[model samples]
Structures are given as C-alpha cells and as structure tokens.
Target: MNRLSLVAVAAAVFALPALPAAAQSNEITIGISISTTGPAAALGVPERNALDFVPKEIAGVPLKVIVLDDGGDPTNATTNARRFVTESKADVILGSSTTPPTIAVSNVASEAGIPHLALAPFPLTPERAKWSVVLPQPVPIMGKVIYEHMKAHNVKTVGYIGYSDSYGDLWFNDFKKQAEPMALTLVDEERFARPDTSVAGQVLKLVAANPDAVLVGASGTAAALPQTSLRDRGYKGLIYQTHGAASMDFIRIAGPAAEGVIMASGPVMNPEGQADSALTKKPGLALDTAYEAKYGPNTRSQFAGHSYDAFEVLKRVIPVALKTAKPGTPEFREAIRQAFMSEHEIAATQGVYNWTEKDRSGLDDRSRILLTVKNGKYVPAM
Candidate 1:
C-alpha cells in the first residue's frame, strides 16, 4: 500500500504542468508615480494610457502595476516613491513623469535598493546612477539639435521663458551651454510657475527685449502658456520647445499659437522619416502602431513612448533576473538593477539603450530629431 501510494503521488506531481517560480509568487509589482493631475498632466495622461500596452504576463509571470499621481510635485513624488518601496514592495519603480519628480523618486529608489526607470530626462548624477535609468534623452544631446536649428535660422539673440522648477533650470542650463558655443546670445530669462494663469508679465518683458527667437523650457500643456502669451503680445519670432512638450495635448491646448513651433524630439514622433535600419525605427513603429490602435489614429506621443520604453526595459531585464533569483526577494531586485547597468544596445521606442555604470540615461544625439508643428501636426524638420 505505501509503495503504490508514493508512486501515484509522484506520478501525479510529474504529470502536472510546471509553473515558473514567478507564478508561485503570484505577480511582479511595478510601482509608478506620474504627474496625472497638475501641469504635467498632458504628459502623464498619455504615459498612463501606454501602460495598458505592457503585457500582463511575461514568461508565465503576471505583472501588477501600481500607478500613483504626484501632481507634478517633487514632495508628492517622494511620498509616492516611499509608499511604492515600503508598502507595495515594488520590484521596480517607473515614473514621476517630469524631471523634478523623477529625481525625487530616484532618490527613494536608490535608498531602497530598487531599480528606477524614469520617464523624464534625468541628468544622471553619480549618486542616482547607482539604481536609476531614464527613458528620455538627456538635455545636452537634444539641446544640440535645437542649437543647430537656431544657428541655421540666424537666431543671434534668444529669450528664455520656463517653469520656475527643476525642469526649466535643467533645460535653461543646457541651452546656455550649447548657445554659448554657437555664439547665440541669451537676451532675457523669465520664470513662471506651471499653474500660473498669466505669463503675460513675462511675455511683455521678453518682447521688450526683442530677441531673435525664444525657447520655452516647459513641458506638457503648461509649456503652451508662454507661447500663447507671446503670440498675443505680438512677438513675431521663432519659437522652440524642448522634447517635454512633444504631445498632441500641447497642440490642442496651444491651438494656432503652437503652429510653427519647433521641438527636439525622438524619431518615433515622425516614424516615416526614420531610416529602415536605424535602431529606433522598428521599435518606434511598433509603439506607434500599438498606441494609435488603442488611443486613435495618429495619436502617438513621445511621452507615451517613454512609458512604453520603461516597460520594454523591464521586459528585457526581468527574465534575466528570474534566471538568477526569485521575485519578491532582495536578490531579484539587485539582479534587475544590475541587468540595467549591464544592458547593451537594447532597442526601444525612443532609441537604442546601452546603459553603463557611468551613463544611466543611455541615449546619444541619434535619439533626437528636429520637428515642427505644421498644419496642426508634427512634421520632420530635418
């Protein structure tokens, strides 16, 4: 009786389909803190929408995504990050859609020894490099694209109007560095809060200065405010924006005022113009197809691509992490973090990522392209 019973039990166990260790743990949790309610809402909304495209199950392991709204505030982002690490026990954290909030969450992820994939353009400081990587291209790489455009257009003097926040400061600093080398003078600098209803005062000051062109260092629909004000105040000059405002919402909010506005953005925004063999081409088209299919025809945004790329990075790393360690464990988190650090030539919707110990934001000049708003659509400028 004992021998037959043992044999039956062993046979039954062997007959059952083998489940992955991740299946036993139930799911892999990914914590996201994006700015869905404040100035960055235009950017965050699409990012939230793109998460729907992330596969629910990867290699037989279900994924659980926990998203929080930070309202574009750094303090709120920090709190959300702490909650994600302590309460959610997230294996990885992705978000806080803008620079300041992303930086705040990066601090928390580093402290908690978890991997963070920021959807914003992070500066990649040595401290944050330990556990953080960014989806958006860094400022200098994209700024050079804008700088060259300005040079071609004979923009001798430029005015600056940006949010009174880290995002603004970062872009302004990068522009300054690039502008100097190109012999472009920055005539005026004005700061405005994201929620400010009146950039009129700043616009007046900028117009009075009479610069050859103006670059607005703001993001999402909020970036439109200054441009609208400038147009209303009759400032007939070239308008340039950063990659942050590369969304349909910006155009809808800015209306005709956004027309002719130029921005440095990823090639995904203009997929047809991309070379077939380019690293970004295939992934960019895939994201564009998936996003437009769900959202609508021609509704893709670089912000959404940023979120999709975050998921792609996870998709590439988690399987490798699982090979070495189980989910919901410290070893697994470390493996994921190390995977990002060791990644090489990984294609994403934005660009090819080749992360390293020094460069967490693994993008170069190839990640950027000049785009212009024409006929209410983004067309490749170069």
Candidate 2:
C-alpha cells in the first residue's frame, strides 16, 4: 500500500499541468547604461531622472531596471552592455547618454541579439540597424534647421569648433551639407576633447576667421567651453550649438555666455505656446508637465525627454513582444527587435516615431525646433 500510494502521488505531481510560461517568467529585465558620472553627466543625470516615470510593470509583466554608469566612456559602455546581456540577462538595453558611447554599446547589443534603444542621436548604419533604434532627431534634420535660421539672419560664413569624436564629425558633416545649400561657407574648423579644461586656443582661431556665425558641435557641459571662451574673448558674432547641447547643464555652465546663443532642439524644450497643429506639442507638453511635477518647476531637459521617449517606444513594443515569447529568452529579445522595426506613428515626448526596417531614427523635421538662450532659459527662436 505504501509503495503504490507513493508511486501514485509522484505521478500526479509530475502530471499537473506546467504553469504557463508567462506566469513562470513574469519579469522583464531592462538594462540601462548612462554617463551619469563623467563628462556627459549633465546629459545623463536627467536621463536617469526620467526613468522614475517608467512603470514598474506593463501588461502584468514586472519590469526590472538595472542602471550602470558608463561615465561617457565607450569602452565602459561596451563592457556594461556585455555584462547586461550575459550576467543581468537583460532582454533589451538602453543608454550611454552621448553618441560615441551609445554607438559603442550598439555593437555589443547587435552581437548579443538584444534590442537597444539609445537616448542619444545615432546615425543608423546597416550593421547596427538590426538591433538598434535612437530617440533624438538625426544630425542632418537638426542641421538643416540651424542652417535655415542662419540664412534668415543673413549669415554667409561660419566657423566650427567641435569635439574630436564621432559626435562632432557627424554634426560637422551634416551641417556642412546644409550650409552648402544655403551658400554658407565654413571659414575654419577646430576640435577639442571633452575633458579639455579649455578650448581657448581653438576659440581664438575661430574668432580670428571673423565668420558671420560660429557653430559649436560638442555635447553636454563640454559644449559650453567653446561658447564661454568665445564670449570672454568678446567675439560677438552669432553662436550656434547642436541639439546635443540641449541640457540645463549647458546653460548653467555657459552662464551669461549662453545667453543669446542659438541652437536646434526637440520641441519638448518649449512646449507651451506652440501651434496646436504642431505634431510634438501635445506629447511634449504632457512630458514637460509630468517631469516638472516630479523634479520641480522648469527642470525638464531635452536630453531627459529623449530617455522618456525611449520608454514610450518600449511601452508600445514590449506588449506586442510578450504575445510571442516570455522575457529573458532569445525569442523575446528578437521579438522586441522586430517590434521596434515595424513600429509606426507612435507619438512620444520628442516627436512621432514611424520606424521601418531601414530607418532606425524615425524622426523628421517635425521633431526639431530652433531655440535661443534667453534669461537663463530656452525660448523659441522663431
């Protein structure tokens, strides 16, 4: 009787229907690598702040976020991406606040077949296209906006000072393409590293060129170095920056030098008083309202808005992915990749995302606005 009863109990236990995969695997891991500690901290800190708004769960699936600081280092970002895939078992990766680090992590994500959404602007290439998407408007689109403004102001010659990195190169190339179309000649081009304490030498050269305007193509607080130097030297032509510098850190660091400076930015920077028909106005205002409520009055950064949009992309795609596979599995990761590729007309804080297999940025002219630093705040340049 004991043997028969024991055998029957064991059989019954084994025969019970296995728990549904979703119930068994109810958590999704998202890995975030940002430059919270280093040169890009001004940009990364706000991005980290925006994560507070990401819901802990979606479609009853618990979300586990693991954030690592890459310190704006490409090597560190690569290591973080690998660790997230191999150790944290992250289904997707987001981060590395600036372009170079984001690009670095993209390689790791592609190798691991994990979907990556970068908050920084990225030039989508064929190799990385399989696994990556970015939140910020592409360089060319934002470049055109700046050049159009320059033409309106009757600026025909420009000088450039940019970071000695891919971010700077991309901006310069894109801006050059636009500048040529508008008959603007770039009189001088100079470069500086992010950690450089001074761009005075480069600024001197740029000012000596006596161009009608100057464009600083660096990001985060570093971009302020050139602007401050230019102002201190009393070179008062026009000064422009890339959208990469659209953070409060740039304003605070540049101080009075930042005033009257013009740049291109996502509409989220100044949502109020926007035309009702503006595509980004409604979503931008919503994000601004939520962000300011949490961080206090007027603390929203366009950099932070990019991170918010990354979450919005996840919100739209992850649910669809869950239908096919459970998280923490290769299939789930691939599902996310496919979902991101096929997404269309998704409105977020920055702009409407309409992605396709070939276009990872999913943003257009509607995504950008021209802004000027006025009274320690960003105002519409139009």
The lDDT per prediction is 0.83, 0.83
Q: What is the lDDT of residue 83 in candidate 1?
A: 74
Q: Which stretches of candidate 1 lie above 4 Å from their native place?
A: 1-26
Distance from true location, Cα of 215 in model 1, Å: 0.8
Give the alpha carbon lDDT tens digit for every residue of 204-258 in model 1: 9999999999999988888889989999999999999999888887888889998
Task: Let me know the TM-score candidate 2 reaches against the reference structure.
Answer: 0.91
Off by over 4 Å in 2: 1-24, 277-279
Q: How do the predictions measure up, each by TM-score?
A: 0.91, 0.91
lDDT of 2 at 301: 91
